[model samples]
Target: MTSQHAILTAEAHRDLTIRTERAAALGDAAMCCITVPDEFRAVQSEYPILFRLSDTRDRFTALAMFGFENGENLFLEDGRWDARYRPLAIEIQPFLIGGSPTDDGIGQVHIDLSSPRIDQGGQGERLFDTMGRPTPYLDRVAGLLGTLDQGYRAAPDFFAALQRHDLLEPFTLDVTLDDGSRNQLVGFHIIAEDRLATLDAGMLAELNAAGHLLPIYMAIASLEQFGELVGRRNRRIAHGRG
Candidate 1:
């Protein structure tokens, strides 16, 4: 594990508390929105992991859907929609399922982190194994992951840019879940600052110069919606159990 991962793990073990409520009363029309601390957001934004669809532009949508991080199953009026595509039949394991601890010894927001059965070569390999050839969508997602991998590989320079501006800071985040009950989570929350906003202008300028920004954002939006669909399905599975 990297230092960043270690830090998050230690934070996860802390006894912080978060506020939560049961989702039962929400009656399938509400989405759980937890207010994460700026620190956590910063860390999340900076972490090398491409957990967010926006970060990778949705290239890993299929992988993310199978793994369980962000999806629509978490919020849907009806829970009978079958995912359009199912990721490779790899074992599904629940990662971080629960609330995060707050800085003030409180637990907040529910978190669930899971890993998909991505093969040794990552999505590309899984795609080949599952379909014999990569479809356009699969190829797109693969390309997106590739781009993100490149960006993460170049994080040293990215960090340098932030350091040059003297804007580097330790991060902390608090999560809250509203399930008609209250829960608390606390620990060492870490995230990189909104260095993205600062970098976006430059990044966008470069992308615009290269004529590849608008298309990228559009792709990202599509993937984000797809991930939401998966989340909604998962949520239905959860509620159906009750």
Candidate 2:
């Protein structure tokens, strides 16, 4: 809903604060797609990492599953994240690194002007220092944005290889919480185990040469965490917090 995005400058954004609570800022999204390729390993241990096509249908995005349903992040409670690892996509919100519409090569930070979490008071880390220079917080944000931007460019090549190998498939997650409530998560995709197995050695070698196999396995391994998520949801409901 942000109508405008301005390039970040020290003078104009001296009063800005980047809120760390992303679940609220992102409307409590159930899935956070990974941007950087390196995120697969870290994300796999905690969340069920999945793959999905981009809105444009031109490429794919890796996602970290947080909850079974929309606006229901089971890992979030009392304004804190239960998991030690939060996806970089979740860590960076309300800010996007984009090119100028008029000149595609002119790249800069684009902030969501409509975000309620993007505030003017010193509620979180200050964007600028007293001397009108970017603070360490801003520097960190720059690094984070840079990583995601690079990831965006790299995802196509990585996912294209998986697509060529026909290793991706649709998935549905159905579970029952302890309170006798059932949850079904849909509209996500997972790596196909049988299809991956069917790949000939030459295709396997190609995937290995492209360095796409490990993340595939990592995503598959992360599916086990779905059980943990159900348990967390059940515990929350049990404690009357749901």
Judge candidate 1 against the unseen true structure and give its global Cα lDDT, from 0 to 1: 0.29
Model 2, C-alpha of 104: deviation from truth (Å):
8.5
Model 2 regions more than 4 Å off = 1-3, 21-36, 54-59, 100-106
What TM-score do all the candidates reach, one by one?
Answer: 0.27, 0.88
Query: In lDDT terms, how accurate is model 2?
Result: 0.76
| Model 1 vs. true fold: TM | 0.27
Candidate 1: tens digits of C-alpha lDDT, residues 1-242:
11111211323423321211112222212221211111122222212112222254321211122222322233323332133322111111111112222223322222222222212342222323233444353354444433333333333343333335433333222222223322222221111335434555776586456433332333224333533444344455567631
- Those runs of model 1 whose alpha carbons end farther than 4 Å from true positions after fitting are 1-133, 164-166, 171-242
Candidate 2 lDDT tens digits, 1-242:
63567777776877788777645554555545454556788888898887777678777777787877767788777677888887776666667787732443736887776766677865777788778888887788788887767666666777888788888898888887788889997767889999999988998888778777887788889999988988888888989976
Clashing residue pairs in all predictions, respectively, total 54, 2
Clash total of candidate 1: 54
